[model samples]
Target: MKKHIFKLLAFSLVALLAIGAQADDGFFSREGKYNGEDRGKPVMPTQLNATWKQECSACHMAFPPGLLPATSWTKLMTGLDKHFGADASLSAAQASEISAFLTKNASNRWTAKTAPLRITEAAWFKAKHNEREVASNVWKRPAVKGPWNCSACHAGADSGDFNEHGVRIPK
Candidate 1:
């Protein structure tokens, strides 16, 4: 009986240690945390839509659909006539195609139920661009303009590559 108990205890200890070692490799880490490449999932969908890419980039960078939730994209798509105070209204067919693309590729990692029309209003965006990481004065710079001008700091913003290591703040 004593020998059996000792064997059981030793096996349990080894099993626990093995599990701990695996956890250290981020097996138990948060979903979006420690994502090595494409940082959480490719912000840009592997399949791109021509209508969405062309129309959206006409005024601003064709923001990666993963930047906002599906609900946000729905609202924005339905309000293209008043898009950011501009009459960006598109034809019915164009609008429908673009809308489908935006909503389909919208952020999967956004856990919050609240949908923000503006990308800057998303919780994840704010957290990543908090004052601690970006100085207040940085937004005031003519080159940077504001947070909306992501391409000013993130050269690959159009390509959906916002990796921290690739950031290049302008003067």
Candidate 2:
């Protein structure tokens, strides 16, 4: 009986450690493509470019490149000077580095041929936030303002988590 109890305790400890590690590493962050679903699954890129983080985030949250397809990223980057009514122009080197990073990590599960410039315009995004899951007025709230304000409800949006389970919409 004593030996069995000790073995059980050891197994439990190992299991707990594994779970802790996953959480610490953002394993449950909903930000990646798995199979064909656009589930809020985190996929930490091997390399997150500094330029992309700084430049793109200056005007708004630096959306995860995995949220869009390569074609979409190329189009967006090519017209950075007129980026959504703002002059988000970057130096040639900076733009090149950011473009490469974005294209490389673009969504793998985006099967549609159309590449939308805005992430919110994507079919998957629309499907996920249909009227059934979100009220019409929710987008008009002062805190929400628009669909682009992902972090307004998604606590981990900045870190590319976007896990629905962790959402906390502001009043």
Candidate 3:
């Protein structure tokens, strides 16, 4: 009985967090609150620039700009030709616009001096997905592939709504 109660409580807590976060309509949420005001705030992409989406998503999911820092976006944009062992080169104009968008929306909580090229490499990412939370063999599963594939587990990943309540790890 005690074990069942504990599980129910845990599930309820997670559900509340997921729903409450999305329902927050504070002043910050009302306004186009960029500049890290909604940095750690639980919200989806309030505004997704079209150019960034079209260009970046052409190769892969245009990862939320908030996933990285300004410096990291700059570096990644500058080296688009050699993006992660692939030739994802973009025109100068496109790169500049996308860079500006990413930098403007970069993670407000990220304070590390080193800007990570991959979201998986970020310290916060590692902390959130530590060995204790995720089993070692989970990564080897064909469905999961690797940590970079956010949509593998997070159904709302494309929209940047990674609420834990909605996560469904693929079998």
Candidate 4:
């Protein structure tokens, strides 16, 4: 009986220690919440696709693939003819390549089951840029433009660096 009890206690202690270690490593935050690896981290993929960069940036910024999920990317890619009221269609080969890259690098850490078409429509984006965080009038500024224009405030937005510390609200 003593041996069994000792073994059980030892196992419990080890399990607790492992949990604590993982929490410290950011899997579970100190506040007992599942923070995950993506929280407040840049979403850029190390290997960028040249075709995606060139085509997507022709009209607007080439958003990082991690901004949306695979499903959203698929939806957007298939509807290029009516893309945001503009014809942004690409060749079949180009579309396939960009689709693969975007899906592969899509938001793996997004907790929400939803697949938002626009990055600005994501729950995480709304929470970060809520009214309390950003003044309503700020968006109306000629230089600031709107939420879609991330580069207006985030200097390194093109590179996937949206850290608040580096943000500069344009006049």
lDDT of each: 0.78, 0.77, 0.73, 0.80
Q: Write the per-residue lDDT of candidate 1 for residues 96-115, one digit (tens) a residue.
A: 99999988888765555678
lDDT of 4 at 6: 100
- The residue-by-residue lDDT of candidate 4 on 36-144, one tens digit each, is 3333234688889999999999977999887777788999999999998999999999999999999888877655567778988775677678888888899899997
**TM-scores for candidates 1 onward, in order:** 0.76, 0.74, 0.72, 0.76
lDDT of 3 by residue, 33-111 (tens): 3222223343235877899989888866789877777788888888888888999888888888888888888876654
Q: Record all residue pairs in model 2 with backbone atoms less than 3 Å apart, i.e. clashing.
A: 29-42, 30-40, 30-41, 31-41
Range of the 10 consecutive residues with the lowest summed lDDT in candidate 4: 33-42
Model 1 CA deviation exceeding 4 Å by range: 1-40
Q: Top lDDT: which candidate number?
A: 4
Candidate 1: C-alpha RMSD after superposition: 6.6
Whole-model lDDT, model 1: 0.78
User: Which 10-residue window of candidate 2 scores lowest in summed lDDT?
Assistant: 32-41
Which portions of model 4 show Cα errors greater than 4 Å?
Answer: 1-42
lDDT-best of 1 and 3: 1
Q: Return the candidate ranking by lDDT, descending.
A: 4, 1, 2, 3
